[model samples]
Target: MDLATDLELDHLVGRARRLVVPGRRRILGIVGPPGAGKSTLAGALVARLDGEAVLVPMDGFHLAGAELRRLGRAERKGAPDTFDAAGYAALLGRLRSPEPGTVVYAPDFDRSLEEAVAGSIAIDPSVPLVVTEGNYLLHDEGAWQQVRDLLDEVWYLHIDDDERVARLIERHVRHGKARPHAERWVRESDEVNARLVATTRRRADLVITGALTG
Candidate 1:
């Protein structure tokens, strides 16, 4: 499972706990390339935080499949331009400081349907932490540039290219793509985005290694 060491996991848990203030909300952004396990790590962190935290993934902001086809961007579905980057940033801003007694709903990406389901995650006002994981949180261009400033801290996940690539291909296959097609998508689409994500690594508050499977 490539589980993180006890000390590493403990430190992450501790850092997440410290982010929780009694009366204020904090957002933690986890960034990684395709198949680097951003969602898995974010889910683990939120689970450890008990009921004090909730996960609102950035994948929720992916442009609808039909919209992508209309824009002639279906072939580049995982690329930066295929997402509603501005809307994601705006959502984060709202989640960062929501109005009192307000309940905010966040979108969720459905892998099987390959669509974003709106209002899937509800963040109550009493929750003190929001864990958002995605590929572009550290990106410095276009609408994504505003994401960093909105996050309390952003952690970058690093994995060997071969491992990450394998994971991407497998995920695609599991989601109903043919094996050969999955390989092509990983090579042509995912790897291109992975290189872009790598460039933003230095901007992260921390770099996590060898925790991709956990």
Candidate 2:
């Protein structure tokens, strides 16, 4: 059976800190379905880790809006294919064995523009830990299958189903979608991806549930 623990933010932070190795970089991946607080928890861990960690979210790998449109995949933007999965895996490889004196720059997803902003995050090679969070880190299909082999540790976040759906809708609305449209997208699009992620829950090194701090 998979180990499921409800750890507080403090305990989680301490746990994350322990994963670091002297003179080597360790990557901790936080993965869950959309609206599962992956980013929130990731950011909290990074802030608490102080200078020891940097966050390089997988959302940064999203294909450009024009690319998605050109490929006629604009509707299901959060699906696995909407991202550059091979590129993400390659970048993870680079993160896993970071070279000395070379800073790895990562992109960030801009909610306001619904696009990826390049070189928005700088990962110093000396930082002991990299906390990456996203929906498909444990996904074992196609190009995403290689993700599991690269990360040092993986944590799966769990939340109430209703709460997760509600949060997704609220997030869409906050990002400028109409309430009805947001609800439809959550029901039709996001939930479909959520089910896919659920299948990979048992693959995580740890399963985290409960109210998160920070």
Candidate 3:
């Protein structure tokens, strides 16, 4: 089956028109550059599902702000090394086992503090689908490689280059950056990260355009 075609949907819904049940322990990975609306699509997917679906964002694995600062990488916060990829891969591997009645705990990002809080969520094994999104899920390097193997499917969301930049600047501002500073960061920081993310696009099982199927 062509995954790209499966991602198309009615524009208003912002969801995939169909859900393919390839097998049990099905994990859907949404990979896209920053500001591509990956999280928005993940939320919509969870809302649209009848039952047995949950969101497990890769952002939860981000290294603590203090850790980034300690490593002198605060300015590169969104870079691949700024996340605990090994830990994330391990968790995904465990979740793929699908142990009935067992619960799996996962970390979550605290946007307010810009840090990762451990054990922010508990995934009940009864959930049949986990909608996970992140920039580096398809990165074929070290621990990131394991992420792809764990996922049952992966989708890459795409948006216009100009629009992505616009959204990134807006996001940075809403997240506390000053206007001019936000624009600078989007161009220098976010776009650099976006370039790295683009390399993983071809690895996606599906490629979606616009907000209609993020």
Pick by lDDT: which candidate is best?
2
Cα distance off (Å), candidate 1, residue 183: 0.3
Sorted by TM-score, highest first, which candidate order results?
A: 2, 1, 3
What TM-score does each of the candidates earn? 0.95, 0.98, 0.89
Give the count of colliding residue pairs in each prediction.
Answer: 0, 0, 0
lDDT of 1 by residue, 76-142 (tens): 9989999999999999999988889899999999998999999999999899999999999989889
lDDT of 3: 0.81
Once model 3 is optimally superposed onto the true structure by TM-score, how far is the C-alpha of residue 123 displaced, in angstroms?
0.9
lDDT of each: 0.90, 0.93, 0.81
Preferred candidate (TM-score higher): 1 or 2: 2
Deviating ranges (above 4 Å) for candidate 1 = 1-7, 212-214
Whose lDDT is higher: candidate 1's or candidate 2's?
Answer: 2
Q: Write the per-residue lDDT of candidate 3 for residues 164-185, one digit (tens) a residue.
A: 8999888888889899999988
| Number of clashing residue pairs, candidate 2 | 0
Off by over 4 Å in 3: 1-23
